[model samples]
Target: MRCLWLLGGSYLAAVDSARLDLSQVAKDPTPLCHEDIVDETCELLSAGRNVFQRGPSGKARVLSFGELQGALHTTLDSLASYMDFIDLDPHRAGPFMVNCMELCSLTVASLPLTHRPPAPDVACYTSDAGVVCDIDVSDASFSNISFDTANADGTNKFEHSTAVKVTVEMGNDTVWSPDVAPVDPEDRDDMPENVGLDQLRISVANLFRIFPPFELEVTESKNLDDVSDPQIVEENGTDAREVEVAIEVSPTHSPTDIVGSGDELELDLSDHEQDDAAVGAGTGEVASKRKRRASTDGEDSPTKRSSGSVTEAAVTAAELRSLLGEHLREIKMAWGDIQDRVTAVEKVTQGHKKELKVVHGKTKVLDQQMTAVKAKGDATARKAEDLETKLEGLTSKIEELGIKNQATGDGSDPWGEYLARRKEGQPGRSEGGEERKSLSEEDQRSLILGGWLADTKRSIIESEAQQILDMPALANFVDTNRVVVFGPRKSFGILRFKIRDGETAAGVKARMWEVVNHVRQNKQTLSSTTGLGDEGRPMWASFLKTPEARKKSAMCSMTRRVAMRLAAGVKTKEGAYYNEDATTVAGYDVDWSTGTVWSGTHKLASASHRKDISRNDDYQALKLGWVDIRAVVAVTGCDWSEAHEAFQHEQ
Candidate 1:
């Protein structure tokens, strides 16, 4: 009947043989609001009581008990509605839903998350046999992926990899549960060289299961054997195998407790022993058999035999703790894997980098040669230009002299032939400006430059260029596994823990100190010399060192008016505090009770705010500069004596 209802619940179950991964479908894209809403509700509810208990001041003002209580109920109701809305079965529903939802919600709200957390997904699988199985999620999937790999001994095989999923009407709604991934033949990489064949055995055991009664029909009027034949070939010409899937119904989880998807199949002989004991109690069978068999095959109190199921409440706590422990282990394992993979990539990358470096060295040599060749060519051209210029001048003068003599009707000496011969010999002129020419000096310069270039090229070849005075030798090393976490220290004016390869204090101290100082100064300026909460004097003088002014134990209108006349301070009273001018002191204000003594105004809120910021005599808070711990550490090399000494004297 239950199976029939499961089939009749809805058509969604029978629609198709999708082998759906309901885990993907049930994924919560939003952070679980469970914890956040609960926390917020609790805090808001408690806020009024806390303020009422402590004499309302600071952020405690405006808190009301009635509103907080009402808000809490509202949050719980909203959460309850959500719990009811998820389609889960009645056999597996209750406080656990509330708890799980609350946790999910709280985690989402408190953290600045960019993506939604993973939710329970459901998937079902069917074998050649008609037997249907149902799997319910009990813990986080990422925490421990039960890989379907077997050691050679055939132990630790996580079967049930491929499972289809569908939403069945649990009791509340048609909510989907977590499912498994399809069997990927290649997801398991090749085993290490040393691993035995047994260790590398990859086999599917039982990744997931589907309930009986096909929702829709993949094998209608056809048996498992009939549908086993290959229908079509895949891209690789391998037969495309398909199977009918159905929505799961049986083996539901106790939503409040540990719900294991695996089996514990040990047989109990205690019942047989108990029956024998009963017979002995009636017929004295134990007395007759007390010799040898009774000692070896013993019965441990027949009354102690367990016949009922485990309680929901008992299992919930244990499983929750187990879940947390598993989460931490996963983090460590994932980190190890990441470190290992990165180390491998680094090696390959380094090899490529080395190749590039060698190529770069070759390029540098070639560049030097090119530079030298260019210089030689430039010098040779310059030399030719100079020689041509000199030759042209000499030739022009000779031509003029010859023309002048001819005009005077004197001897035609035929000097042009001699001039041409002299020009050629001079090595500057080239065919009387018919073409270009080179100067001898320029040619000499080219040869000198070329020689220098050659020498520069030689320097790069025979020896490496100069490095640092005594540079450390470069070497290759890899740490591809675990990461070491360092201790916490003051970094950038904030208390920070150093993770392995995490941010360094040295890098951020300067900027962090600047912000801290700025905020501290502003705090001092706002609290001082005013007839605010100081009442003319500070309550804490041991920690603060502020300037002087008269203060009053009891505030009066005259004191408030006179304080305005007497000192400088900010008038930052909020709307709620308007009835009572409850603005606090910042600078040194006079304390009539102490008769005008000095004070120190420290304001480390995490410690004690009043103790840090109050003056005993004067009602003023004093501001002071601070030396950054990280910078001090860097400069001083080791001892924190300087910072500790300052902190000690700060009072």
Candidate 2:
């Protein structure tokens, strides 16, 4: 019974062995392997999920295993719908389609692929018959093939050159359920019930059945009687001559006696002649006695000829049947031998496949290793190229400097002393050492000055930065503060004090340098300056260098007026406390019980507003060279706001 699975169902049909044609089916290019289908279904599902997960929120959520499985089924159904053929039937469908449906149905029952992870390893291969799928994708086609042709005995006749060691296991669900706990590799069994393996075997068998390796067909057809005819022509084209000779003598001999002999018996023409004479003599006496013998001889001749024809026909039919039977038996034996060979070939192919699988696994491992090695090699090559470039630049600089490679009169290379001292390094080198031996006087001075400037700037900046960071109130004024050192130009090196949002550039610099100079004079590190942030200590003392009389005279009249107002028990506006004119500078205590205000001889708000204007005064003068500083720029974020407001007020 031949059954084809098509359109989601199996259909059975009776087909003639001789008339079964697979030519049209073999031409089909459709990929119906179970593994291919599953892989495509998985890929499609992943693609759809990626599409659905993209959102304006920029959040991508991947589907869970159950969700993915559902998607997989949907994808498969969609693919099948598009792939369905209207003209396809049991006879019209290819073997690939039939076997794919059969194998996929069986596999789905066992695997179901429920809760399977994404990217299941699935692959397939094509053979003459149909597609063979390795759902687990553990193997590939045989890489190196060889046959043991010298085995005269049929044992291991087409076996692989190498022996394969295959270990099987039972009672392990993980072999079938890969997403679950893994099977113990140490477990052993001769034959295990592995669903994937069984599916593969069934698929292979079906493939072979659909496309057999060998076939026996009738080259020519003829009747048994036609086969019995002699191949070569007889002499004179007369078959009747031998029959006539037999009829003349064989009346006395029994036909049944001659047919019984199975040995090599030749016809004796001499015995036939002797038998004919004896029969003729006996008949001669009867003829003489009767004068009517001539009439009787003529009447008996036709009857004798008719009996001879019947005997010849019987002999020919028996010979034809015997020959036909022998040929048929030989043909059956040959066919049985062909079947054995096919089975052997199939076994060899299976062994090769197993070995090929091992090779494929090794190849994948090798490819991964190669990828990692290539990445490392590329990184190392880039580093080497960069190092080479730097070396070339340094070499060119050295050449431009005219530094000779020759040994000095003291029997040492010019750079040897420096190299030796460099190898035995210290925290700080001596001024008299070979450290600057190769440098000219100016270069040596520049190197020394530059190092000193960097150290100085680092120490000063560290102190100032620490102060700003320690005083959280300073955060309202300073965004960033650091020291930048530049140049050993011909003479002196420079250290630029940089500050962001420092409206009072000179005042900030004056304060910063004071801390730096104190540290230098005291021979103390930046961490030792704990007095810088003291409440009464003034670090910006240089910004306050002004005439004492002018500072006192600016607000003396206002101070006196505020004092009088408080003395007279006058109530002052709340906002007037911040006025530079000092609306009420005297501190007074109110006596509510007596309904009177008592005045104290002191100021409420400073009449000069020294805290606000002192820094602004110094900042204005710093632009006119009241302070000696260079490369200092205070980038004020509110510079325009302050200036624009002042302009508006003047207008």
Candidate 3:
């Protein structure tokens, strides 16, 4: 039965109407060709020959579809076995097989016809899309095209005179169709039989006019899958047998056309071998092995062919040379790819080095900042230590000053004494028996400066004092000298002198009132001054109003001996006696009218009769005198009758 073929959306008769015997087709090494469809198959053969021609006077003869199909089926079976070995998807195998058959058919159908066939070396390989075949056609008539440079249109221009190497590629998901125009049905009846043949040849030739060979079929949908199982049809409402017709066409680049380095090629081979081992284990079949054709006297041994059982014609010397040349081109491409990979790796290394340098710089900056912070911390610690030392010294100096004030009788509470004098209406009098006058502002300032200088052991000078007064912080408080003078004096001598004159009580009162009013006027200035901080300077009113000061002011003043006696609750005068010149008398009589004491009719000498009473004995005698008794009575504010009764009882 004649096999039908689809081309350009139409069914076409193959090379012969008679059925091809499978047995004869398989046994025959040379392909059978017929005159009627020679143009169609030769048209495809010419396109492959254009890119690669072998030997001088290179030519190709017509091939029958049966022989072409058988060879392609063998290649397809080998590819399927390899795909199975590599564990590819089972669904893709059917489509991939169909696509490979169609692509091979298109290639074989594009060659020029000749009487004598040129021997070509053919090899098939697995590609990303499917299988690809490389046919050595280096002897074809039009294989001398060269590309020296690209044209202005961004296309590589060809010159037919020089020998050049070229590659053609067809992308995935693309469609292709013959460029034949529609024949006019009316004109077809009058047209010569050869005229239609000539038109077909021209249409096939037009397909290869552009570089890279294949043309895109823009009108067809890209999602078409002609390899799917065909739908069944019913005849007379009865179910007919299921009929499946599938033909798929796809494009791909040759092995030389795939640009890559030797490393990538090796990686691809390793991946294939690994997959082959896996699938082979599952299927219980040994993975295929590569066979290197040993050269004997520079000729490919006839025995060393592919592992497939299909018989092929003996390879000629020219075909062997062509295969070697193809291998050489592959080596050159791999070297170029390796160089490109090396350059890219170097660029990445440089980028990493620059990043490391940046990190190092940042680390150094951080280190420097840490060092500065450490230094600041150390300086702060030293300052704190110095402050602690100064505080200790001030504490010791204050203790020493306290001891000295107590010894010199200046430690007595002057604030209490001043309050007492006010209550008694005894304002202080100077040595001249006149009331002391308040000092002028200049004299007060001078006194304050002199006192401070003496306390600090610094030389007192008018210029220095005026300079201190002229300071911006102190300028406004220049007239407030009374407040400073009344404050706790550091010098015991000055404090003693002030206490003796008793001029500080009224002055302190008046100065305190003035300070209160001044503070009110300068509240903002005083509060804002940096020297005073948030609370401002202490006022005399607040200081003197403390609990200790108030408690001291409330207490009554008495001599130490009288206070001791009162505290002991001694109401009787049992210890009253008179002692003089180492002689002691137990009984004493006080002559209240004459202010004299008599001891057993012997007149006791009073303390005032001695010229020096600094001795302890003289001091004791002074306490025994009637004068001291009268003075105690006056100080205690007791009635004279009670005092006389106490003395009379003692007598």
Which numbered prediction scores highest in lDDT against the true structure?
3
| Residue pairs in collision within model 2 | 585-604
Q: How far out, in Å, is residue 310 in model 3?
A: 29
Every candidate's lDDT: 0.28, 0.29, 0.31
What is the per-residue lDDT of model 1 for residues 349-456, given as tens digits with 9 covering 90 to 100? 999999999999999999999999999998987676566546655664475555446554566554565686777774223435333332222111110001011122
lDDT digits (tens) for residues 105-189 of candidate 3:
3434443332112222221222234332222222231122111133334333323223334332223222221112333434332
The TM-scores of all predictions, comma-separated, are 0.19, 0.17, 0.25
Candidate 2 per-residue lDDT over residues 354-419, each given as its tens digit: 999999999999999999999999899767656654665565446423423321233645456667
Cα RMSD (Å) per model?
41.1, 34.5, 30.6
CA shift of 115, model 2, Å: 72
Tell me the spans in candidate 1 whose CA falls farther than 4 Å from its real position: 1-379, 382-651
> What RMSD does model 2 have?
34.5
Better of 1 and 3 by lDDT: 3
